[model samples]
Target: MPGFYYPIYFFQLDAIKHGVSVTFSFYSLVILNASNFVGRVTSGYIAVFVGVINLTIVATISCSVLNFGMIGLNSLVSVVVLGVFYGYLSGVYAALVAPLITTLTPDLSELGARMGITAFFVGGIGVLIGAPISGALLTSKYIWWIPAVFSGTISLTGGMVYIIMRSMFIRHQFKSQA
Candidate 1:
């Protein structure tokens, strides 16, 4: 989630760096938010058929690709396009993470505690660490690609983690059956 949101947090800065005015940058966010709403609502239903983990992995990876695409973006139109796509993918991730957590927990009684712990790491620690690191990468020079790469790499790493978790779950199920 932190990885998913890093681009959103710094979007204005990215826009300014790429020669977009502050006023237009705001519209990009509005567009993003609108599309995000659609993605969140639709992904919930899609997850029922496609599976939460599978969709999440796809969304996360797609978001990483979009972030990487940010490296060379220089126009408002392109940025707006990127925002629309990123917003949707990030929204998918946001909607599915809770269900993914539920699947990981064997004891339903521990769900709340597990969610709290996960939230602490994702919401608390990740936010704390991610922003600063991305900011530092940008620094006074405002080299956009540096932070774009950072965010993309983080998102990609997150997707890989889900893939590993899914594989582990499948392995566990097979072992138990055997």
Candidate 2:
């Protein structure tokens, strides 16, 4: 798929005649993989104190900015910058998953049960679908009507949902206290 898609996107810009096939590809993947590993390890160690929303908000914002910028990249330098930023951001994203769920449910034993049911059925689909659908979108330049547009839109929507739900929960908490 990268082989098929890279050429088209490569041709679209003057910086990469063949896109980032050789050195940059490996470098990009390494950066992303290393960051993901670090994020997960750190999240595992220090998740007791930080709120899940805060960590995930950082990840989502980073991704939103990078993904949006990736769409706008026109030069080799921009591509490299995009890769580094995206890798680090996605790394943070990997770190936030467990805390996000654990905090949402917040019962040690019960967290297991809740995450199991939700992760496999609901969250699994997002991971499954986000890529293929975005890949299908060959045109997202002007109107952002393709996969990238949809991905960013979903991220924004998720943020909105979090805010609304958090507000409702807070209101409930206040009323209960009252």
Report the C-alpha lDDT of model 1 over 1-178, residue by residue, as the tens digit. Answer: 5556667888777887789988998887887888788889999899999988899889989998988988877898888898899888888888887888898888899999888889666567877788788888888988888888988999899889889989999899899899
Model 1 reaches what TM-score against the true structure?
Answer: 0.93
TM-score of each: 0.93, 0.72
The lDDT for every candidate, in the order shown, is 0.84, 0.56
Model 2, range 1-178, lDDT digits (tens) per residue?
1111221232233223336555555455555556657666666455455556766666665566555555566556665666556655566666676667776773588988877777656777766666556556644353333444555566756666666766776687789799
Clashes in model 2: which pairs? 134-147
Among all windows of 10 consecutive residues in model 1, the one with the lowest summed lDDT is 1-10
Backbone clashes for every candidate come to 0, 1
Give the CA lDDT, 0 to 100, for residue 133 in model 2.
60
Instruction: Give candidate 2's error at residue 120 in angstroms.
Output: 2.4
